[model samples]
Target: MGGSGAGGTNTGKRPNGQLGSWFLRSGWSKGELARQVNRRARQMGAHHISTDTSRVRRWLDGEQPREPIPRILSELFSERLGAVVAVEELGLRSAHQSPSVSGVDLPWAGPQTVALISEFSRSDLMLARRGFLGTSLALAAGPALVEPMQRWLVPTSAGGQEQPEDEPVATPSRASRLSGPELDLLESTTAMFRLWDAQCGGGLRRKAVVGQLHEVTDLLQEPQPEATSRRLFRCAAELAELAGWMSYDVGLQPNAQKYFVLALHAAKEAGDKPLGSYILSSMSRQMIHLGRPDDALELIHLAQYGSRDCATPRTQAMLYAMEARAYANMGQPSKTKRAVRMAEDTFSDAGVDGEVEPDWIRFFSEAELNGENAHSYRDLAYVAGRSPAYASLAEPVMRRAVDLFAEDTDHQRSYALNLIGLATVHLLKREPEQSTALAEKALKVAESVRSERVNTRLRKTLDTAARDFGDVAGVVDLTERLTAQLPESAEAV
Candidate 1:
């Protein structure tokens, strides 16, 4: 909880000129400084620090405050300065201190955002472990979700600032104009990563996908024709979104949020409003899974507002379906059903005359919609007074999803998830035998994928089966077998 630096300790003999200088430059009175520090401390969940002008005077007189106060001061100055104001800069070094994450605070501008994401990718790649990125998922629900939504909604500068010109523009080369082949490679690679993630889960190849992101960053630095540049930005946005999805799947919610924010910036640069809306929708989904249905609802509203005119029918259907999910989580069956109907109607309209849909939304087919509906029904069954009718409704839809996924082997992870959903429905229906059989099949399929989401779902299903029918031999045997297959951490869950 101490600061970091190589500064000599003043024995409270003379005034600390550095502290006084920063304090003056910050344009805050001593009392105001103390009050701001106390407020920020409380927000960070630190022990309350009673402060006053007298305490500030003592600091100015070369009397260093106790542990944690220096760190708090560093943070406050950093925020005010719009730059990293280290404890060392504040001349408040201490011997015993806890470590802190190397924070990145980028402005919500165009090229700066690109630099921020590039630096983030490099830092993330170099770190041997997740470090601060491994923090709890609950931490992702607050500003991480709100900031991106707000930034996306706000207009930047007039004339719509162009993306950064390729570096070293004085020299003309192939790097000055991105060729068709480079764009195609990027698009195909993104598609391949998406497919692999759907089939095998993100845990297996997440780092490799991130490595591709590093390559994309290099491409972003190169110049291109106006059309090619737009396409490149769009491609970068899609790849970043995929990285976010993989990060979420592997239980790295905070890292996932970073990737999503980057995707939003790239989408905006590309002038792809619908793609930006889709990224917001994805963020909403993550919020919903984190049990913040209200936040998720707000994000969906933003997505709808931003893309009301531009989003195609297919994308609109997907957004409405997400809205249904948020409402279902909030236990508003009436609103949920309304949203679902809207989604269904829009989807039907999109199908007329074999109308082509955006490639990004091609995965939201009837089967995907059915699966989404089944999940909504399942959530309603649990939260809406445990309505048996909803449970009954979920079963057949989930069955259809399972059957659909079974036919498409490339979505084995999703197929396993559907099986888990169906098994839960059976358990709700009090059919222990069917539940046990379905749970076993799900576990077997899930074993092939390295998804924390699938593992978590399987654990939940097993927990449900054990609670309802622990004494039944079939249920007990199935649970034990599944437990044996899972990692120790997941098995414990």
Candidate 2:
């Protein structure tokens, strides 16, 4: 119990109970415990917990904790008890799980879903850290809702029809200036996010920054003059596309797909056909991730038609490469090779004049070509695994890719994966020392990024090592630890 104050007046008796018992065991005073609990609670916006002795006494006396307070209690008590003390044990069952919102699940969803998704997305950082297993995306909210709508807007009816050769593009120069704080803010934020995306990954940044997207969209919707407004609209369209990309990074596929569609709509409204095509390409990439290669192929073809002349050569090359990857995924070797050839041509053409190229296209270089080919070969190698024939392309392509993306900014994950891929190939080819060396390099790189994707792929390489190199004691133990730390996606990949 808390004793008298400085003047010897009775401050208040600390209630004797669970919080007190834990505090005694931990040798922390009520004031100290309260300070820590309140600090963490304030960070999470649950301000009900007070540092006052009376309230801490009530908790110690076995009084039930309220929402969020229980979580704080759990944290405080866990430290006291020298082990985890669940909120349920503290009589705060209400705080067992994080709060859930219904509608904000989708960025491009209607008001309700948007709010729900935003809330959930924001909470994911803490939830993930706490090891709370999230529910899988509900089946009803799958691609069914948006796919039909997408097909309707970009109907296949005129899919084969080409725009006239005489079609002219409207180019707005400095004379047609765009002026506004919103545009400036959008540009500033976009560049900042892009830089962060390369370093820490889109996953790490998306959860925190996506909330600002709504405000940006709102600003773009405000009334403005025609020319400036068009520019604002285009900027908004790009923002939406970026929002979609970030969504995919955090494993929210359906929500991301919806944002891509919304970006496409915004691009069309801004009369930016090339931007719309880019969004479609992004959507196709998501489709490939979802194992819908057929859909991905069709979307890439649509992008090719829509962006034939409007898009820069670099974007065209990227689309072709992605399409080739899709074909490789589908086991269509002939089409895959053909698409690869087209990708080469597009990249060569795009490299002709650096002066006219966009900043976004600068990453599309010879090194990037090596990286893309490596990924393509990896896809092919996976498909060939189920067949009788052994793979030949995976090792060489991965080797080239690792060399190419070595110096590329924020590509540490890819470099690690390429090394892992090389290791996997070496294991397949019965070169144990070579395989282990490459795997070690991959593990070092994986430690640098908070990427489950990199970790997961590395796990596959390690698992193979375990199976084939188990005879060696050192190899066996290393593989065991790597296998133990493997994430869920590791098995799937």
Candidate 3:
């Protein structure tokens, strides 16, 4: 995709050790970096730019690439490194980097947190207008989050821990405060947004979610009564977390990571350790989806350990399930099974009614756990040099997940995933007839949802079906339909 055409002038000819270090850590060859940058540039509508490996060499040799190139490379590496890598972090010293794109780092406990949420939400709106979802810039992951997570675990700020709901936090300013009833409305609105996200998918309501989240950030700048303030932060945390999930659904990894951090900060402000832990687990899920299970383990372990005293048993179960997913992705079946067992044991200890807890985690029921378990087994089944036993093991679990997931709009994505998973299981068993038929049903269900995650799984299943049953009429029909109708790039951003 690179061209040997006219481009930015090389600013220097010195050895750029900084860029070299990052290029090495990026796990990309020079040509690959050029290719990925070109693709990312095309996504941003810079169609004329055709960068090649020679240009990359010049960059590594301390040549300052022109405008947009620095920014593009920053976005690419940010996602690749699973951290918010600024241009400077990449040894890119171009003066053209936009301040809006570069200012991703935010303080954890301060007024600036409010500022970031406001600016981030507006920028999200701008990105939507530019044919992008959530954020295409300013995302961070893993090590970039270490300090913030540490802050969350042992907060230094006063009134940072759980307090009586009605108790006013120390040094409450006399700024205009939002009413408790008004905050209640905000909370209810957030719940409604969550339902819409699950039913219709993330792309449908991102702008609205970002807008409401921005409004909440504005409210946070002013002082409210203790109860109202905690409620406001709780609402903001929920909305921000939803925004992050929606971003993830659309395959915008950077956007998701940025919003997840915002949500975690808000959760901490609300003295909600459980919610903070949930946000960390969400970040871990993103890492797993992006195939960085090492990073996933780091986040999952942090979530499990940091919230040990505060997280409910169901929450613990969710964290352990995330742990299992990471290990399964690494093809470590033993550790994966151990984590799943721990998840099951902890979940069982949640008391038959699931121990009255936060509304957000109510979905971690038998069906959800079964879905996670099936996913672990499915991952193991596909691992290199694995035996067929895992494939057979996943079938019943996948079937149960399909049966348990309600046939309603609310559980549309999960239902479709189960169908696809079962189809994959059949494909692995070499049963083309059943696999293709089930895949057809999944394709129909997925057509109604707008999740790239769902699309990614469907693509993988179809690819397997094509490879294993290319001659089967049903597989041919399914493949034809998918090829003709869907062109979504399923790779995680």
**Candidate 2 lDDT, tens digit per residue, 1-493?**
3212101122335443544555677777777776766655544444443556665666665555444555555645653443445444554443233223221122322222234433444444444354331222221112443353343234211122334433322323333323567567766776676556556545566644455555544444344454564555566556666666765654444346555665665555466666777778787777666666777787777778777877888888988988998898888878887888899888888757653754344556776666676566667766777331234565666677788767776666557767777776676667778888888777777666555556756776777677778787756766766656544332110
lDDT of 3 at 168: 38
Residue-wise lDDT of candidate 3 within 3-81, one digit each (tens)?
5331566666777888888889989999899888777666655666799888888888877776667767776776676
Q: How much lDDT does candidate 3 score?
A: 0.76
Instruction: Assess every candidate by TM-score.
Output: 0.74, 0.63, 0.82
Ranking by lDDT: 3, 1, 2
Which number leads on lDDT? 3
- Candidate 1 yields a Cα-based lDDT of 0.73
- Candidate 1: clashing residue pairs, number: 0
Cα miss at 234, model 2 (Å)? Answer: 3.3
Show pairs that collide, candidate 1: none
Deviation of model 2 at 39, angstroms: 27
Report the lDDT tens digits of candidate 1 across residue range 340-438: 889889988776767666667877877788888888888899887667899998888888888898898888888888888888888888898998888
Winner on TM-score between 2 and 3 is: 3
The clash numbers for all candidates, in the given order, read: 0, 9, 2
| Predictions: Cα RMSD each | 11.9, 13.1, 4.8
